[model samples]
Target: MGRHVFLRIVDVVSNFDPYFQQRFDAVRRKGLSHLQKCTAAMCMLAYGISADDVDDYVRIGESTAVEALKKFVSNINTLFEGEYLRKPNENDVQRLLQMGEARDFPGMMGSIDCMHWQWKNCPKAWKGMFMSGHKGVATIILEAVASSDLWI
Candidate 1:
C-alpha cells in the first residue's frame, strides 16, 4: 500500500516542471536525496501520519523523518519564491479581468473558496491560523477565475 501511494505521488509530481527535479538534485548532494525526504514529508502531510508513525510507513528513523519534514518545507519555500508566487502588476490584473470578460463573465474578477484539510498535530501557538469550520481541522484558501458556464 505504501509503495502504491508513493508511486502515485511520483506520477503526479512528474507532471510538474523540471524545476523541482533540478532543485532536488542540488539538495541530494548534501546527503539525503530529495526523493527520500520529499516522500516522507508528503506522506505525513497527505496521509495525516504522525511523526512517530512515519518511521513505520516510510522505513526511516523518527528523527530523520522530522528533519526531512523541516527540510522539505524550507526547500519548498525557497523554490516557491524562486519559481512561482510573484506579485501581480496592474497590467496583469487587467489582463486577467479581460480574459474573464471574454469568457462572458464580467465583474467576476476571481472566485474565492476555502478547503478544509486535517491538521494532525498543530501547535498551540499556531492553532488559530489553522482553525476551520465545524468538523474541519484546518483550511486552505483557493482562488480562481470562473467562466460564464461556471467552469473554473
Candidate 2:
C-alpha cells in the first residue's frame, strides 16, 4: 500500500478498538493478534477490491481474505442496531448542519450518491443486486457525509 493510504487508514481506525481482541480475550483467555487479517479487510473495503485481488495484492492466502471479509462484516453489524440504521441522533445532526452552514453549504442534512463499478466474472446468481447505471457493471452501495466527508 502507498504510504499516504496506509497512514490515512491508520488515522481512521486507530481510535477504534478491534472487535477480535475482545472476543479472543473473553473466550480464549488470551488475545489473538491477526494484524494481517484486519489490514487485508481494511484495504479491500477502502479500495473496493475483490477478495481475489486483495489476496494477491496483500500477499495473503485466499482463505485469509475470505475470513477477513467475513469477520469485518460481522464485527460492524454487531455495532449497529434498530430501524434508523445507525444514524446519528438529533444533536449530532444539528451539529453537522451547523458545521455545513459554517462551510457555506446550508440545508444539506447529508449528501447521498451512488457509483457503478465494473465487476468482471460476476456470478449469475448475484448479478441483479449489483446492476446499476445503464447496466454498465456491478454496483457497490455507498453512503457518506457531506460535511465531515465520512464513508458509511
Worst 10 residues of 1 by lDDT: 15-24
Off by over 4 Å in 2: 1-33, 43-59, 79-85, 100-106, 110-114, 133-135, 141-143, 148-152
Which one is best on TM-score?
Answer: 1
lDDT tens digits, residue span 36-67, model 2: 56677877776767777876666767776777
* Alpha-carbon shift of residue 149 in model 2 (angstroms): 7.1
Model 1 misplacement above 4 A: 1-33, 116-120, 124-152
lDDT of 1 by residue, 4-90 (tens): 866654444433423224243454654444465567788887786877787776676788788767766665565455434466567
- Residue 121 CA displacement from its true place in model 1, Å: 2.9
User: What is the alpha-carbon lDDT of model 1 when measured against the actual structure?
Assistant: 0.62
Which candidate achieves the best lDDT against the true structure?
2
Error of 2 at 1 (Å): 8.3
Listed per model in order, the count of residue pairs whose N, CA or C atoms clash below 3 Å is 0, 0
